[model samples]
Target: MNRCRNWRAAAAIAVAVSSWTGASALSQHKHVSDEELLNLLKDAAPASVFAGATVLNMAPDGTMKVVREGNNGWTCMDPSGTDPMCADAGGMEWGKAYMTKGPAPQRLGFIYMLRGDNGASNTDPYATGETPDNNWIKTGSHVMIVGAEAKSMIQSYPRSPKADPTKPYVMWAGTPYEHLMLPVK
Candidate 1:
């Protein structure tokens, strides 16, 4: 039973990594629900982690508006064209920086993007296509686990800011806001 459970988790991780890494082979994937996203948070961390967090909804136009408030200091986002993610206050700061293309801030933030729904292009920061990355090589599904400190901790990766299709890369690089591009698979 344990082995079976492990296998399932591994498989789930594989799919998640593929989905996040710009592989849109699973373009027919279903949209993730709020409850499922919350459950995914619980699965990723402890419920106490989100005791007082802020939830934001990121529109396709790159608009991030506040949805609600939590007791925890953490912040979560319901991003269009990708998986739901939760981040620390520092992560939120990094997000603001990313959105405004402002100076880098060393907030030491982290992000959890799991149980993905493919529509984002790995190359373009905001491609709304169902199968976003037409140049993906892996052709699988996955998710992203990122953080500023994780850049050095992990093997590294960077996102392409233009039409240049890129493979799995770091969330925000070149700035102190850089994060790890941890593909779940």
Candidate 2:
């Protein structure tokens, strides 16, 4: 279906956003075999989701290749190798907007990063590396709630720029792409 393909593309773009962030040794754009990449991305979400989710691998040059096809409306990827994630259509839209520094979608979106991340500056949404004032944090397995609904919860969680990443907190708070990050482990 065209809708399905569109969402897949969105998911690919979403994964690109993660890949563009902090560069860890593992996040480096190294050439990984499709089979190996698929295995690594399997941890991005639960088996139920991963079983039917489309999988993709992104190159350092920003190109994307489909590693697997699925019937489910979810997209999984691990371009950085260190930050595997599975995102739904809404989540993909949010990522696309965030990547372009544009307005976030009005609806809610979900993103799963059960394998954790390579670390990022909590205070600076676009921070590329750790710095004394950047509040760099490496979170464990977690999921994210994005878009307007998540923004509404900003007042319910820790929105401080230096909020702890190990707990439920608002990332990119007070910004158009602000979202809620919830730890699962």
**Using TM-score as the measure, which candidate wins?**
2
What are the per-residue Cα lDDT tens digits for candidate 2 across 1-185?
Answer: 46556655665574457533465433456656788888888888999999998777776665777777777878787756567888887887887887788888897889899988888877777887788998887878999999876676667898887877779998777778778889999
Measured on C-alpha atoms, candidate 2 has an lDDT of 0.76
Point out where model 1 deviates above 4 Å: 1-46, 57-68, 117-119, 126-178
Query: What C-alpha lDDT, on a 0 to 100 scale, does residue 118 get in candidate 2?
Result: 82
Candidate lDDT scores, in order, read: 0.44, 0.76
**Model 2, C-alpha of 135: deviation from truth (Å):** 0.9
- TM, every model: 0.50, 0.89
> What stretches of model 2 exceed 4 Å from their correct place?
1-4, 11-15, 19-21, 24-27
Error of 2 at 1 (Å): 6.8
- Cα distance off (Å), candidate 1, residue 95: 1.0
61-136: candidate 1 lDDT, tens digit per residue: 3333444556566655444334555665555555555545565455466655544433344344323343533332
